[model samples]
Target: MMNFHFIWPLSGGLLIGLSAGLYLLLNGRIAGISGLTASALGWTSGGVSILGLGFIGGVLAGAAAVFALLGHAGLTITSSPILLVVGGLLVGFGTRLGSGCTSGHGVCGLARLSPRSMVATMTFMIVAAITVYVTRHLVGGF
Candidate 1:
């Protein structure tokens, strides 16, 4: 039997919603992590550098706090380190190609009822399912 921690996902969704809502409300900007990270590179004194940094910092700090309190949620990764890096790079590339990520499209876009985001989100999910099936069941047995 698989054990599921429900509050973790719920809290994550709340934080994502809160972050996105707050950013839009305060700065009149859409809260996209990729865009924020990319723009942070060209960050000047003002113009959301602090805002972006604070939002991201809060996410990291929150994760650390959770781990510290929970004493490691006991998750493990089976993929090799190199494969993980390559997979991350590929996902980043795909996000750039698609103009957003699962979080941006699936969460915020779906919330706003965007047709384009709906298509993008569904396409990404289908592709992800196919990839996982092929990697784990097909090629994984080789």
Candidate 2:
């Protein structure tokens, strides 16, 4: 018998990796969500990439499909609106500062064996662990 707990996450990871790989192979672009988003919004020099818009649309569509199927039963956000906003702002700033997000560095960059991505991913993991510990143990909340 197999433990079912890991199956869903494992499957999701495989799907993400496959999609990223396929997107790169087909488009000659790294599927970095932050960069794609910036390009789609015309923040980048190209004045809006169709491919970036398509990628964003696909992601939203996929999320909508999942919500339609699952009905948001297991989804919960315990954070306050202010905290969420602050977090979002921080993430955006960090993405700009780091030149990429986790999807870019962790998945695509790591796949390409980028040294910068390696260091970035390690920093991300360590910071994440520290954040989790502080929030769970020190600050005390889910």
Q: Pick by TM-score: which candidate is best?
A: 2
Point out the worst 10-residue segment of candidate 2 by lDDT.
66-75
- Give one digit per residue, the lDDT tens place, for model 2 in 1-142: 9778777678778878998999999989889999999999999999998989998998899778877877884677898898889889988998899989999999999999999999999988998899889988999865
- How much does candidate 1 score in TM-score? 0.85
Computed on alpha carbons, the lDDT of every model, listed in order, comes to: 0.81, 0.90
* Candidate 2 displacement at residue 5 in angstroms: 5.4
- Distance from true position, residue 65, model 1, in Å? 0.7
Candidate 2's C-alpha runs over 4 A off are: 1-7
List candidate 1 segments past 4 Å from native: 1-4, 43-48
Question: Number of the top candidate by lDDT?
Answer: 2
Could you tell me which residue pairs clash in candidate 2? none
